[model samples]
Target: MYMILKSMKKNKLRNLVIVVQLIFGIVILSNSLANYKYYISTREKAENASSSNVYEVSVENKADIFKVGEARDHQYISGEENQISTVYKIAKESKLVEKIGFEGLGCNSCQYTNEEENEGKFILKSKIKTIGIVEYSKELTEMYNFKMKSGMNFSQYYKSEKAEDVIPMLISPQLSKDNPIGSIVKLPGGGKKYKVIGVLDNSCPLLNELYNMGCLYKPNNGYFCVIGSLLTNKKTHLYIKLKDGVSKAEGKNDFDKKLGEKFETQFFGLDDMAETVTLPAPYAARYILFGIIILVLSSFGIINTVLSTILKRKKEFGTRIAVGATKAQIEKLVIGEFIIFFAFSAFIGLIIAKLISGQQAVWDFSVIGISIGIVFLILVISMIPAYFRMRKMNPVDLVHGR
Candidate 1:
């Protein structure tokens, strides 16, 4: 302990460099851990949203698809509506298909507008961010496989023959508690109003991310309204949940073969447009690679410092050897000095990291434990030169300064 303090006091600059290296290593590691936690949480939510065996199909009117400038200018027949009807008929007849639904074009970043009355004057307040708006069929619940938290799904009204008098909506549980069942939600720009009929489970981060972030709603869980002309609109997307043992490729092949026979000129397929649901960010590899690089550099710095210290204290080590100290005792003394330095540096690093990142930084204990392990690994690396120096220490070398 006395030798450790003496060494520290004599090699202040070298010790300071080691301390700075430790601080940098810990701060980098803690930041990476915080990012890793965020990435994992988002990935888990995305995974939960996609556990169902659902497939997507995109279709557009053959005429509208070919000539795309202004949709309003095209005076074409409703090819999309006909295709949707045919697809629905084919799906219902197939034993391999379970449920099917249609979703209109939606945006993840849009604004929600509403009116607020301030002293007899109506003021407009816009919620600048939303998950966009989409028209979802009753069968969407089956396709999404979301557990209903409140009210009911639109399954009973899935049939085209049974026209709905009022639009019904199924929302996330975060949105449902405030709106409740039977409450009316008005759309922006004075459009159609929807009745909140159901609340979905905590899953489905697609919609829930915006809701949880305070972007979707002003006073409640946000609002959903039926829009677009359903099957007639080319912007609509088909979501189909296949029966057990059915792969997406198989489903796509069947749809292509069947639809090819009907629409000779137009192309309608699922595999070309759809992607499997998973968080696209490969944060695990990115953070791990960076961490390894930084730690390697830090370890080298520590090793250099340790070697320098040993080189400067060669006479001191020789004197100890002459005084009948064992090589093992000298080694312990050298290793013990580093152990204390590292332990104290780690403590200071953690405290500074917490203060800087604030509450947003998630400190995973597993990550912290791994960091400590790495510190010890660095200690072992730094001790390699000391181990060899102590082993070679003798009375002649101590006196002659070899």
Candidate 2:
């Protein structure tokens, strides 16, 4: 190791160039891998949810029948409610519907506290705009394949105990990390405290989308919570999951006939509903392609530099061999130097990638493992030409400048 470092120091400019190329390659590769992993995971979850035959049912008031001027009138409100109820009734009566769920906005004035105590001392964690509180049914949990990382699901909470002042809630993984299960958080001004009964899995589609809500306009400042209550209000969106082997067209046809001509209903699959959340396939592919190109170019450059460096130092290796050093020892010294260079470069690259990607970066075991594997692969490939050249050199021939 000491000799390797001494040799590297003797050729500082050459080693510095290698390290810079490696750092550049690693930075781009890490960022690309992180994004690609995120995209694949998100797409997997969306595809899984879509395969469950779930569809979102959206009801809109007919623009022709409801004049724009009567939007706030009591009659308009009643008509809207009636239409939602009629659609709900149709969904309930349809045999194609295996289960139904409703999701709607929660209290706008609700403020969440990170405080653990129930003594009314509240430390505001987030406001209404940054935090999304969704009221949903227990069936929604089953309909969309919601998994719990810890604690109990909404059904378990529903069966346990009922508190008038405390509401049982399931929070997203991001929020759950800060406020784990059994954490008592109050929604001040509403006279209700939210009890964290469940922590949702990271793969939950709803939470995933909610977590990425600020990708367009904001800096990803969003948290999500779900309460086990079905809101039948006009603003509530309905979800229906079909039984196995049932086609969406069948459900749509039945719903269209039952909803009549007064109300308009539209259906959206999970992918369609989450189009804004997941990264596009083409973009992810392009990122990965660019990263691969950089990585390959950097690897080739390093290989050429290593081969050149080895050729220049043939007299040094020959002198070492004449002094009783074996070929294996020489090879080990060369490999060790590159390993150190790659390790330092990778560490620096990871930090830079994290800084650039910000909230979107993923640093899981898979990413780290793959990055390490790629670096080692590059190291081995870069040593190939040098290894062959060194093997063919004879101490006498090298000393004679042959």
| TM-scores for all predictions | 0.58, 0.73
Encode model 1's per-residue lDDT on 59-156: one tens digit a residue.
44434443433232233224555546656666767666787767655443334443412211211122333534556555664444344566665553
Among all windows of ten consecutive residues in candidate 2, which has the lowest summed lDDT? 211-220
Global CA lDDT of candidate 1, please? 0.55
Per-residue error for 147 in candidate 1, Å, reads 7.6
Instruction: Judge candidate 2 at residue 155 and give its lDDT.
Output: 67
Clashes per candidate (backbone, < 3 Å): 1, 0
Question: Highest lDDT among the candidates is held by which one?
Answer: 2
lDDT of 2 by residue, 1-402 (tens): 888899888878877887787778787777878876766666566666534788877565556455543433333324545555656788899988889877765654444343433544442244333565667766776665556788987666766767556667887766766676887776544445667888876554563253353232111244667776643343456678888988878888788776555546677777654554564545756766676566667778767777787788888887887788887888887777768888888898888887898555567989878877787787777778767877776767766555
Residue 149 in candidate 1, Cα distance off native in Å: 10
Give the clashing pairs for model 1: 175-221
